[model samples]
Target: MMKIYLALALWMIIAEHELMSGAELICKRRINAEYRASVLMSPGYPFAYPNNMRCEWVIQAPEGQQVEIIFLEILTESCCDTIELRDGNTSSAGLLARYRGNVSESIYVSTFGSLYIKFTTDDSFVFNGFMAQFRTATTKTQNCTVKLDASDEPQLLTSPGWPYGYENNLLCTWTITAPEGRVVSITFVEFETESCCDYVLVRHGKSMRSSMYELGGLLKRPFTDVSTGPIIQVIFRSDSSLSTSGFKIQYKAVKRTKTDLMEIPKKDKCTGKIEIPEAGHGTLTTPGYPEKHENNMNCVWVLVAPPGMRVSLWFTSINTEACCDFIKIRDGETPTSKKLGILSGHSTKFAHYKSSGNVMRVDFQSDVTKVYSGFRAVYEVLNDSSEEKCGGDLRAAINRRQYISSPNWPNNARSLYCAWNITADEGYSVLFKIIGFHTFRRRDSIQFFDGESAIPFASLRRNTQHDDESFYSQSSNMYVIFRPDVTTVQGGFRGYFVAVPKRQRNTTPSILVSNLLGQHGRDNR
Candidate 1:
């Protein structure tokens, strides 16, 4: 029998000083506590491991269940240092995997009752280690592909065996067709997959060879699409290597009425110009505030807060014809000011927008057809406090530092959708450091961007409970956004932002090193 080396966290806690510095932990202390769900990391995660270390672990699941393992990150000596997975409790069992180099993927296998993992490293250099998660699942699984036709009813589609890494070398497809004179809509609730390599391909018609229309990408963002005709097909493919959380989509068919098909004349009731008072806040609605808006209309709203105070807009509801009839928000009074973001589709959990100055403009345009319940938004004047309210925009002083927190933070907080635009003088950059963080897993996120863009340079979401290290900006402007789900609120996040002179950023690290050396000298004396 192969020797089982168990290096657990709780054991290290009990004997921290006695444990060797290069030793790695293979499993957790309690079998029952970690049996259901747990994440496993290579010996020293987020850090490189020492040379000449060998580790082995045997994972045993409940009878009649299989074990699934997912590698979050894997980097090591490509040929020498390797990690292997076997299907039995011993080395003599069938080898399920032997991996090295830059390999990151997920695996699912049945070892009858236990799965054996072995890691070997020679006396040589090292790199950042691996991290993985292991869980249990039933032997019976869903098919790789599914088909649906002649159905107008709503249905749900998920990646084969979701909430787990999908199987390797798999292709799954879903087809939906409306009864007659109806339209099909596919709304992806959440989608995360390996871009290009493993993806979900969408077609406007019935088959893989459909030429009417085709739309497919890695679907990293939440998306919803309405087919141009009655038939729609979706294909999901996964290679033999890496996999992701996959996706869950909702599909339905809507019957087309006469009003939905024909172009309605523009109504003048809510299609005229509107302006809010200079004192500060008010609400605005589309042509029909609570009802489906009219087509072929144009509306504009100008918000003027006090001269020094900026304006903030929050969209409480947003449902347009997505891309076709859309709302545009700008930071200034003119049509050429910084365009904040084009609003379309369903409202996101976080829908807060802010102006860089006291003046902001909003323009809404609808095509001749296809309209949904229009948007309802409200604007407020931002105060002068360094600590602004949650869900509004905030700016940091060029030479000073400030703190930001979620609404009711360090305690149960409200569903928060907030943004902070930290800016500095022309030769400066911004530095952000997380003080603390806690939120509902998988449904909330705090993202950081280099400029006024939607794509984030880095983000902190749930499941990563560590105090985030500080982030230094390459530019003078930085944007931070916080979005939390509606239910199951938790103690939210707090962080500090400071502006640093770009010229001094390089020397700042040396200054810290000298300070550390001085402290060590004093200790030695």
Candidate 2:
């Protein structure tokens, strides 16, 4: 029986060599000799494979048997050329392994009746391809857990079926070790999985109690984390149902220096109450300001100014998931405080706000689906004075118009800095008409913004006459800023605003009422 088996293997090798010498550019074959080991090779075994070549091979075992494959050599372009192994007969089956670059000898066992192998090359570089041997085994073995030692060069780690979704009911773990006096760092390049039923748990040490992160859901951007020590363990788990494209990670060993051992500065908690310094200025940032924030976070921050002073906040940057996350600002310290604005999505420009009283509250909430880099803001305490008293929150009525003007408008107003927020009812937009416009030709300006964004949509400056010129808001709010040089005194601008349906005609005439009685009559009707 041994002699016959050896002869059959020799015959298979001769046949494969003859086939390789043929003119076919693409090669495919199947092997079902359950009792004899068979060799699999790329289109050109010891030589460089041709560019744009694709080859496939299927090895099948009899009932109650499993297929095992051992790699003898693999050399290909780092990322552009590749080899893939699946557990079943088709490409859609659960992935067993993927290889690129020069890999050491490795072994893989199929969980099903057959194993599928595919080799593909791009149009660019080519290299000496892979060679493996496969045979059938009577016992089944799971090849899920893997241990790796980190080196100066980075290494790639991926889920069982990365790029393609992983299989269900999987419990895979990877333990990475770095040399003494060094630490391990892992960066997630792509991440997506079942939000509720799949998770990747990372631990700084070998034990579960040392877990540093339990990550799931979808990450919109790449982020890196360093382990506390020289060892880290990552575990991936999935339930019996739905799956998604799993995660891809790159890891390397980095030396720990003196700076790493020094005491690090403390960061503010995710939820806290802060008091502004006597200097009346400070800054605040989301938990992971420069990096992607975590999923499913609800953080709140309250800022208290000195007695009799109000808080003015400026957001330098803001980026969050557009649909399921928000940063809400309020006028007071409590959740029930009057809302100022709800900001979300990537901010194209900076945003600024001021509270009516001494306290302001900020609330940030994120859902479990996706995450992005959050916001950064600064605050200052401002006392009520001539320069700070011109701007206030204004609500527009459907029938009556509200008017706003620069400080001491129609007069020589000087040293003024003012801002106004105009809001209309839901489903309505603010209509602003400049009834009077006059300012120093080159020393004063009035700017208009569409919503909470700081990017101005329009501006009046340089003695430009804007009387009877009108603008409309894209949403229920509009922001305006009026500023004049402290050295120049000039006649400022005036504007009237009213709430109108979004679909209303821009040519619609403004409704002007003279007295409170007429306004009340219109409101009552």
Candidate 3:
């Protein structure tokens, strides 16, 4: 028997070599339980196989006997070049195993009867393919179908005959039930299937009758579905055409937590109020101004300009917690108004807001932790007619104060050139108070001139440190000029000028002189 096997093996090798080189020969032989082989090689034997080739062979045994095959070496183009095994020779035979990837140890057991092997290669990457040996098994094994049931303890599931293309007209289903209030997540370690013709469907719910969501196509990565409750069902179906290597899936169940829920800030209980004047503008800040704001707090500002004019707002700076804390701008004063946009995180670009009517609302909310530097914005009247032209003349009575504002004050000040000639009744000095100021630092400016010459008494820009301070002019006639560039715009200044009578005696000091004269004067004498 051993001599006969050796002779057949040598003859098969010689025939394979000749056939690979385009030669043909005829031989008649029958394989039975006694058939065995020490080695089997691809067509080219030890040399690299030619590209774009497909080949098949069959090894058979008697009834009630299985086949066992072991790989000695395998080198081929990874996935693109494949060697596949089947349980029988007929077209109805089911797939058993497949080889790809780099050379590795491989062993396979086939069902009763015979095992068929197929090798295919692409146009590129030719390598010396695999070599293996096979023999008929002396004992019987279980049937080829696969079954799986996954619970809290994770389990792996696959197609009917994994690592190989499933037989035609097959329907397989696996049910996975996790603990109550927990969801299942499926991670694909390996996957391949006929995309539309033969597919795997994954549905959520206790059964298919309840709810269903298909797993789409074979994925290269893992997929987790938490929306579906605790139950998941997977179904695999194959058609009667081309088959492919199936899939391997790893599944786990995860519990629901508090973070999964969404958090909405309470707007009705916010803590700020803002009302910008028709010709005036003002700066609004988060609770802590430039510092990080407190967590778990909601701040709201209601901005109202003149009746005919609309309100405009722009953020000078914003740094806040991402997602958890945000600033929402609205077009109207109520909660049901049209929503503009919500902003959060550290942003380099600026944000601008415009109201449809005379009123606009802003709301800010913070979460439990990770507070950051809040925000500062200026809100002022958007004068549709004025075209953001600042500077004008002002005349006030003695001991009276008059309001003055930047062009389109509170709104973004565009490229502008304007001047204000402020005069009191010839005898009073002018006092200027900086109410709210924001502009391009140093580049855009508001200057207080002594008279009409180029010399300036005070120059102000977006310097937050000193913008809030006050400045007084010695002369009754004061010239104020504002020039803003178009490239960088910001909320301009809001201020007022008050006229005071010159050389007015200090009334409190005069009263002190009268009180001291009657008693302290006699003691001094």
Q: Best-fitting candidate, measured by lDDT?
A: 2
Rank the candidate models, highest TM-score first.
3, 2, 1
What lDDT does model 3 reach? 0.64
Please, what is the TM-score per model? 0.28, 0.34, 0.39
Q: On a 0 to 1 TM-score scale, where does candidate 2 land against the true structure?
A: 0.34
lDDT of 1: 0.65
User: How well is each residue in 108-150 modelled by candidate 1, as lDDT tens digits?
Assistant: 4432556777777765558887887777743333474456654
Query: What TM-score does model 1 achieve against the real structure?
Result: 0.28
lDDT of each: 0.65, 0.73, 0.64
Worst 10 residues of 1 by lDDT: 25-34
Candidate 3 — which pairs collide?
Answer: none
Q: How many residue pairs clash in each candidate?
A: 0, 0, 0
Worst 10 residues of 2 by lDDT: 511-520
Candidate 3 off by > 4 Å? 1-269, 272-283, 304-309, 334-336, 346-350, 385-392, 396-416, 434-442, 451-454, 461-469, 485-494, 500-525
Best candidate (score: TM-score):
3
Candidate 2 lDDT by residue in tens digits, 1-525: 999999999999997767655515446777783657878778776888877767787888888676767789999875457788876788766555567778777655554568888888876678989888888753312566789999899999998888989987676778899999889989999999887657786777774235344678899999787888999887676756698999999999998766555342233348888888545346677787779987767788999888887886766568887655788898998876877877877864435578998899999877555788897776766433234348889998897876676765555566678888999999998888865565544457777787888776666654433455577777899888887877656556666789988854444323221222232344331
